[model samples]
Target: MGEAGFESRFVAASDGLKLHVRVYGQPRAGRLPLVCLAGLSRNAADFDVVARDISATRQVIAPDYRGRGLSDWDPDWQRYALPVELQDVLTVTAALGIERAVFLGTSRGGLLTMAMAAVRPTMLAGAILNDIGPVVEATGLVRIKDYLGKLPAPETMEAAVALLKTIGAGKFPGLAEADWRRQAEGMWTMRDGRLAAAFDPALAKTLEQVDLDAPLPTLWPQFDALAGVPVMVIRGEHSDILSAETVAAMAARRADLDVLDVPGQGHAPLLADARSIGRIAAFADRCDAA
Candidate 1:
C-alpha cells in the first residue's frame, strides 16, 4: 500500500450533493494536502496514476465533480456549472478540515484553481496548472465540446478497449495494449454489460453555453495572485489551448513560476508516464517544503 492508504468516501457538498472523494497519501504529515482536480468530464480515477506517483509526505484528494464519475448526477443541469463546482471544491476541503492545499489542476480544474484565487486566495498553498493557462484557446475548447457526452455503448470490454484505442490514437500514441485497456477501464462505467459515459448525459447542456468565437478573456490578474507562492505550468508542445506568447509573458512576470512543455502531445498531456510522474513528484516535494 502507498503511504497514504487508498480509500473511498462520500463527502457532502454544500448543495447536499454527496461527492465521492478518493484519497491517497498520509493526511497527518503536517504538510498542506495536495488536491488533484480532473478535467471537466473526467473524475477522481483520472488521478489514479498521478496519486500513486506523488510523494507520500502529503495527502492527495481527488473528487468527482457534481455530475461526473461516482458523484450523484444533478437533477438541474445548470447546477453543473463552474460556480457549483468551485463551491463543491471548497465544501469538500472544509468537510475534511483542510484550510489550505496545493492545487494540481488539469484543464477545467485549472480554471477552478484560478477562480479560487479570484475568490479565496488564502485557501491555496501553491498551484500547478497542468496543460492549462488563463488564456484558453477557443478552437481546442470547441473540440472538447464536440466530444462531451458523445461516448457510445460498447458491447464488450474488448470492444470498449478497441474504441478507446481508435479514439485516443491521435492524443495518446505509443501506448501499449494494456495501457490502452487501463485507460478505457478508468474512463467508462460498465452497466449490464454495456459501456456508458461515466457522467450524466445532461451535463452536456452546461457545456453548450461556451462561446468559442469570442476573444479569450484576460486571466492574468487572477493568476497573478499566486505570484508569491510556488507555481508551475505544464504545457503540451502541440497544444492549441495555451499559446507560447502567453506562457512567455507569465514566466516573465513571475520569476518563481516554472514552465515545462511536453513534446508530441496536444490539448493536454497525460501525467501517467514515468517522466511526467517524476516531474510532479519533484514539484510536490518542492511545494511541501515551501
Candidate 2:
C-alpha cells in the first residue's frame, strides 16, 4: 500500500504462523497471476518495483516466508528447510484461491520453484528462474554464506547502501548508487532506532549446517518436470550462481527454454530494470495466451 495501492495480507501457515504476502492488482478470470519468490535472506519488498509494473496487467503476489519480513519467525530454525517453505507457499496460495500461476524465483527461490515442479506441477503455469539452476556452484554458495544474516547494523540508511556497495559492487558493476540505496531500503527494516536484517538471524543456521566441501546434488529430474511448462531463465552476465554452462545444459534438455542474460549483475539479476521487467511481463502474457 505504499504507492500502487497493493494489499498486505497475512495468511495462516500450516503451523499457524501468520505469513505476509504483498498482493498487487486483482485476479482476473482468464489471465494467470504472477508469484514472486525472493532469494535467501530477501523478502516480498525485493519484488516491489517489478511487481508494480506487472500488476498493471496481471495480479502479482510476493510473499515473505517464515522468519522473513512481516512474517512470524519460527522458534525452531530447523523448520526453515525448502519443504517447509514450500508448504507455507502452498498454504498462502490456497488461502488466496490461486489455482495456477506463473512463478518468478530468484536464487534459493528458484530452487523452491523446481521443488514445486516435482510436487505440485499443476500450480505452475510458467516459471522464470532468476540466476539459479539445478546445479548450484559451491563457490557462489560460499560467498553467500559469508554474508547471509550476519551483516552489521548500519547506523544510517545511506551507510547500509555504502556497506552493500562495498560488498557487492564488484559482482554487480552495473548497479548505481540509487539502485543500491533502493536495495538497502528493501533489505533492512528500522528496529529500536537501528536498521536490522529483514529476516531472522536464526535462518543462517540452515546454511551453516551445509557442507560446502561436499558435492551438491543436482535437481535435473525436478527441473526436467518443467518440460510441459513454459520456462525462462534470467542469468546475470557475471553471475557465479547460474553459470552459462548450466544454462546450455538446460537448453539441451528443454530446447524451448528462453534465457535472458542480465548485464552487470551477479548471483541473481534484480528484476528492477526496465528490460528485465518488460521481458517478464511479456512472458506472463505469453503464458496467458498459451
Instruction: State which candidate has the highest TM-score.
Output: 2
Model 2 misplaced regions, further than 4 Å:
1-4
Q: For each candidate, what is the lDDT? A: 0.80, 0.91
lDDT of 2 at 111: 84
Error of 2 at 47 (Å): 0.6
On a 0 to 1 TM-score scale, where does candidate 2 land against the true structure? 0.98
Instruction: Give lDDT tens digits, candidate 2, residues 162-269.
Output: 999999899899897778988999889998788899999999999999999899989899899888899999999888888899999999998889889888898778
lDDT of 1 at 83: 85
Best by lDDT: 2
lDDT of 1 by residue, 154-271 (tens): 7777888999777767866666787777667767887666678788899778768867677868788888877767888988877778878878888988887878878766666777
